[model samples]
Target: EMVMPGDNITMEVELIAPIAMEQGLRFAIREGGRTVGAGVVASIIA
Candidate 1:
């Protein structure tokens, strides 16, 4: 999905596959083809 500055963003994910105890999931927020923010999903429920 493409996003512009000052835009609001929302996301929801449903995990159907098993994730390992030590596994890491990464997410990146980008604008103008450049990354503005990045983080990892430390944990998820449901």
Candidate 2:
């Protein structure tokens, strides 16, 4: 599903990061080989 602008929700995700992520880490949200949006790491669970 597509996330609309101004939406604040918590959901689980998986990523391949070059660096370890912590609170406040930001990343680009990619789809179909292109970036659709951006997001920040709110928490990490592993």
Candidate 3:
């Protein structure tokens, strides 16, 4: 559950909103209104 810098891994995430889930989709992980990390959708599970 902990990711270090420059580590590439795939994790299954649950979203609370109906947002677009597709490959190449960019996203950011925020904490305290600041971006902690960022990632892109590589593949969809369903």
Candidate 4:
């Protein structure tokens, strides 16, 4: 997904366990193997 500087990108993942209680996951958005943006998983329980 292409995101503008101020635009937002949203993602969701489902796991058997609650991700918030366990160690968080790491993710990075990169271009040409150079990181443009990075973040950890945000656990949203619904």
How many clashing pairs per prediction, in order? 0, 0, 0, 0
lDDT of 1 by residue, 1-46 (tens): 9867777655555646875533266777578999996656665655
Q: Estimate TM-scores for all models.
A: 0.38, 0.62, 0.77, 0.38
Q: What is the C-alpha RMSD of each candidate to the true structure, in Å?
A: 6.0, 2.4, 1.3, 5.4
Q: Candidate 2, clashing residue pairs?
A: none
lDDT of 1: 0.64
- Which lDDT values do the candidates have, in the order given? 0.64, 0.81, 0.88, 0.65
Candidate order, lDDT descending: 3, 2, 4, 1
| Model 1: residue 23 alpha-carbon error in angstroms | 5.0
Q: List runs of model 4 lying over 4 Å from the truth.
A: 1-23, 44-46
Output the number of the lDDT-best candidate.
Answer: 3
lDDT of 3: 0.88
RMSD of 4: 5.4
| Model 2, C-alpha of 31: deviation from truth (Å) | 2.6
Model 2 segments more than 4 A misplaced: 16-19
Summarize candidate 4's per-residue lDDT along 1-46 as a digit string, tens digits.
Answer: 7776767666665656753443366777678989887666666457
Q: For residues 17-43, could you state the per-residue lDDT of candidate 3 as single tens digits? A: 878678999999999999999999988
